[model samples]
Each structure stands twice: as C-alpha cells, then as structure tokens.
Target: MALAFEGKVAAITGGASGIGLATGRALLEGGATVVLVDRDKAALDRLTAELGKNCLAQVTDLLDAESCDAMVPEILERTGRIDILHCNAGSYIGGDLSETNPATIDRMLNLNVNAVMKNVHAVIPHMTERGSGDILVTCSVAGHSAIPWEPVYSASKWAMTSFVQIMRRQMLPHGVRVGQVSPGPVASALLADWPEENLRKAKEAGALLDPSEVADAAIFALSRPRNVTIRDMVVLPSTFDI
Candidate 1:
C-alpha cells in the first residue's frame, strides 16, 4: 500500500545534514511538503536546490528563541498547516565535566535541549488548535546509556527523552502524538572530525548505524495510524551492547 504521508506538511530542524537530511528526504519522497531549518546557509541552500520547490529551506539559529518564533510563523504562512515536527537539530561536544567549559555546556544545553523545547512550545498551540499533530525528536542512545567522555551531551539528550515522555502523556488527550528516536552511531558529519583511530575503532566495534536506517524508523513512527502511537524507538547496530 502507498504510505499515508502524501500531502502532509513537515518542519525539521538541522535538516542540512546527517539524520535530519535523511529524514527530510524521506518525507519529501513520501509526498510531504518539507521545510528545512538549519544555521548553515550554504548547506541549506544546497539541500533546498537538491530537494526542489517541495522543500523550503529556512536559515535560522535555533539557539535563539526569537529566531525559532519567527520560523514557526513563516512555515505556517507557507505551508498553511503543519502536520509533523521533527526536532532533529543538535550538536555533540565530547569531554569530561571537569574538562568541559561552561560555554560548551551552555551551548550543548541550548542547542540540544532548549531549542527543541522552544520549537515544540511555539508549534504546539497551533497543533492543539487543530487538535491533531505528530512530534518526533532525535534523541540519542547516549540518553539511555552513559558515556563518560560525553557526559554533557548525554545529559542533554536524557533531558530531551524525559521531555518527550512527559509531553506524550500531556498531549495524548489533544490528539497529539509525541515520540523519540534514539540512534546509535551514524556515518555523518557528526563524526567528521573524530580521530582516525577512534573512527576506525568505532567501525571495528560495529557501533555505526546508518542515518538512512534512522530516517526509515522516523518515517515508520510518523506513519502509524492515528490510533497507534509509538512512544520511543531505539535504532542501533546489532553489534553494540547499548
């Protein structure tokens, strides 16, 4: 049977690369009108060109609440309605708490946690008014398992996972569905600067999960019948323990 996403409208943060880019492409292929939000203007432009008119790119720093507020209205004006929101913009700075600077911690919180919350808050009222919507957040497996080297990143993701759980409970009555995807490792720019040795080790350890796999899972969750809600999904390489 054909997928049910045809004619839907979606907004995705961090749509310039990695899992976000993969998810956006999947949505577009499924016949959804997609809006790509990212801070990287060049990458956004390239993606917009590649995805064509069905995909609109909005360049904005999601770290700032005001910018996020502006983006919501622009998307509404363009799409007329938003059926799905994929909170996929995030960053990973690896270090122990003692070695991590306050600025780094702040940036992690702002980009990974606060920004997702702000976007959800901004779009939720409209969803509530419509009495139906779906929200999918790109949390990480780190949220479920601790990583000593990336404590702050894990903490932020854990917070996001918690928020999704709470929001799912609260929004269910309003016909809103909230879910999270926790991906293991993806072959994306997020690993672009990793030490060659570490990269090799991760690969050898079989910890790499494809971004397309995660995107497929997101599409699956969002495509579930309205009566079926997927609360949380974990997508990881079979070789990894966590």
Candidate 2:
C-alpha cells in the first residue's frame, strides 16, 4: 500500500511561490492540511484562497526566530498537531564573490541557513513529544559541489546539507526524520538575482527545472513508511552540469 496523509498537518515556509507552493499543492491533494507560510501577505492570501480550504496562510518572516517559533503554536491551535514541516524558505545569491556585496551575503545566509536551523529547533521538540514528525529542508545542488558563479550561495546550502545530516542523526532516535531536497536551477524568483549571463547560459543549456518536479521529490520523501526515511535527494535538470 502507498503512504497517505489523510490526517496529517504540514507547514511550509516560502509558501507564497515556487517550490514551497508546489509542495503545498501536492500535500493538499494527498489529504494533508497545509499551512502556507510566507513574508508576502498578499501572495499568501491569494495562494491560500486558490488552494481552497485544505490550506491556511500564515504571513511570517522566517528571518526572525520569533516569527519562526510562532508558527508551530499557531498550527497547533488550529490543527492540534504538526505532522510535517518543510523548511522551504530560502534565497539565492549568484555571481562572482569579488563583486558580491557582503551585506547581501549576510542576508542570504540568515534566510538560507539560520532560518532553517531556527525553524527546526522550534518544531523538533514538539515532534519528539508526539513521537513522530518529518523535517524537509529545501537545499540546492550548489551544496553538493562548489559553483564558481555563486560561491556564497553554495556555502549557505552546504551549511544546510551539513545541518540536515546532523539533524537526521540526532532526530532519528527521537522519531523525527530530517532530510533535504537539493535541486538544480529552477525557474523561480530565486533566480531573479542571477547574473544575466549565467541565467542565459542555464536557459540555453536547458538546465532550469520546474518547481513542481522538486515538489514531487518532496512528496515522495514525505510518503515513506514511518520506519523508513528517504534521507537526501538531489533533483537536477538533465542537461545541467556543475
């Protein structure tokens, strides 16, 4: 029999667009009630309305730990339990390191790395107490190998990869599964900051993946048997190299 989420509750950050929204759609179809967390209030309202009653919207800024902490309790208030957490909120910084603004680097690191850590910290204990939960971080192929065009972005993802591994080990004993979905270039706003040349190169090379494909990967991991975990998965455009 296949896995199902008939009564599961999932909260996804960056849920206003891209992979987060796509993943929320998939979970809703699988019978899981989803909370779409995003900083954009308008987008959240629109998306939540589109997703219908199975989905709720929580306007939040993941960059703030307090905002991250508030999501768990809010979900509990409405749904009574949190069965899954997809830390899908993240940003991408592209281009040469010399040309990169240090401040931009700091902001990216906060969203991509620190925010993930904080969200996990806030939710893990609740999951442990319940004796089960799943944490899925949205990582990147940049984490697997160094990309010259976006060194700092790669570093943040590398940090997430490390965090996922460590969390997986630590959470396993407590019945919480931690994993990551590392994708190659996707046609997302994250790529909005990419240097024109790199974006053109990736487009010309057919290296841009669709957000829905990554969503499918997430659903697969989430559907695994309780005793089994998919761990880490990398989804890339077939033509994308490095």
lDDT of each: 0.88, 0.89
Candidate 1 Cα errors over 4 Å, as ranges: 1-3, 192-198
Question: What digit string (tens of lDDT, one per residue) describes model 1 on residues 98-205?
Answer: 876889788879999988988899889999999999999999998898876678888998999899999999999999999999998788877764457767888999
Worst 10 residues of 2 by lDDT: 1-10
Quote each prediction's TM-score: 0.95, 0.96
The numbered model that scores best in TM-score is 2
* Best candidate, lDDT: 2
Considering summed lDDT, which 10 consecutive residues are worst modelled in model 1? 190-199
Task: Give the per-residue Cα lDDT of candidate 2 at 189.
Answer: 90
Question: How much is 186 displaced in model 1, in angstroms?
Answer: 1.3
